[model samples]
Target: MVNFDDKRNFYRMLLNSEVKVTIIDDEINSEFVATCRDLSATGMAIEMSHPLEMGTRVKAKIESANASVQALDVKGKVVRIEEEATDLYLVGIAIDDMD
Candidate 1:
């Protein structure tokens, strides 16, 4: 059998860490706690209790356990969402900018 590698441009890093997600809209700025499942240079997958609408702008932050390491902070938009279970959703975000 021929072996095939992932076709993604960037490699994904699997994670099970808490992520702070903030929805930034013209009228509302709500923050929520979610779990980051996987991350790549351009995108990330997160599991949250509620589903986010597609194209909703958001900011995500992940703090590092080590003091020496910097936290991951990025601004992105919701690109995909899937129902993983009742009251649970897997959301995919397309990273736009990083801080």
Candidate 2:
């Protein structure tokens, strides 16, 4: 059986994301505390305080922060978003491979 929706869906992507991701921008910017919903080599799902818009570039420090998936600090940009209730958003960030 051929499924059109499944073939074109990006939601089916597999990720090994870690929780407890630390969002760090410049000194003038306050850090955003988030959790990893899923993770890939290039990106991760971060449930953040704000619904970060797509294309917004930011830096992140991959720490268990308090959880178990303690990743190294990384750089990346927002590529996608998922709305979950009010005042909360599921953001998919594509971490920049370079520092």
Candidate 3:
């Protein structure tokens, strides 16, 4: 048996924390509670109850405080979506801006 490593620009860290995901569009503006599955400097993977369309711009905020920071806010775009289970979707977001 052989194992192959994934080729990625940035390393991803596994995180199972709850974060707020907001999608603001001309037609609709809504927010959803999502779980952050993995996080990297450039992007993150989140699991949400609803599926967001590809190319959708979103805002993600981490409210919980860690040893280093109090909170974090970032602007991202939806890059990919995968159905994890019934009524659940895993979304891949590319970070555009960070604050």
Candidate 4:
């Protein structure tokens, strides 16, 4: 038998944060504010306003409820999008250094 683990990082420290998402496209742009439920070096799961479909790419800022920084700016692709209740979206994004 083999152990099957899905998470890339389970032991890494996760901080609860509220982040802002800027979805940029050639013709359209949208802004969203969401609570970051979990975070890692590679990715984060955010509770957002609208459900970003899987593979949707966007720019994000990891701003906490307390402060803000320049290092939080990054591009991400939505790997999974989950909807809870109505008008709320749980989106899993894969962070990338390359823009």
Among the numbered candidates, top lDDT falls to 1
Cα lDDT, all candidates: 0.93, 0.64, 0.86, 0.72
- Report the backbone clash tally of model 4: 0
Candidate 2 TM-score, C-alpha based: 0.62
Off by over 4 Å in 4: 1-6, 9-12, 64-71
Best by TM-score: 1
Error of 4 at 34 (Å): 1.2
**Residue 64 lDDT in candidate 2:** 50
Clashing pairs in 4: none
Q: Encode model 3's per-residue lDDT on 19-88: one tens digit a residue.
A: 8988966357688889999888999999988898899999999886667766779999999999989988
Order of candidates by lDDT, top first?
Answer: 1, 3, 4, 2
lDDT of 1 by residue, 12-86 (tens): 888999999999864678998999999999999999999988999999999999999999999999999999899
Off by over 4 Å in 2: 1-27, 64-71
lDDT of 2 at 57: 71
lDDT of 4 by residue, 1-99 (tens): 112364565433455676778776524777877888876678778886678767878787874344553447778888998788698888888888633
| lDDT pick, better of 3 and 4 | 3
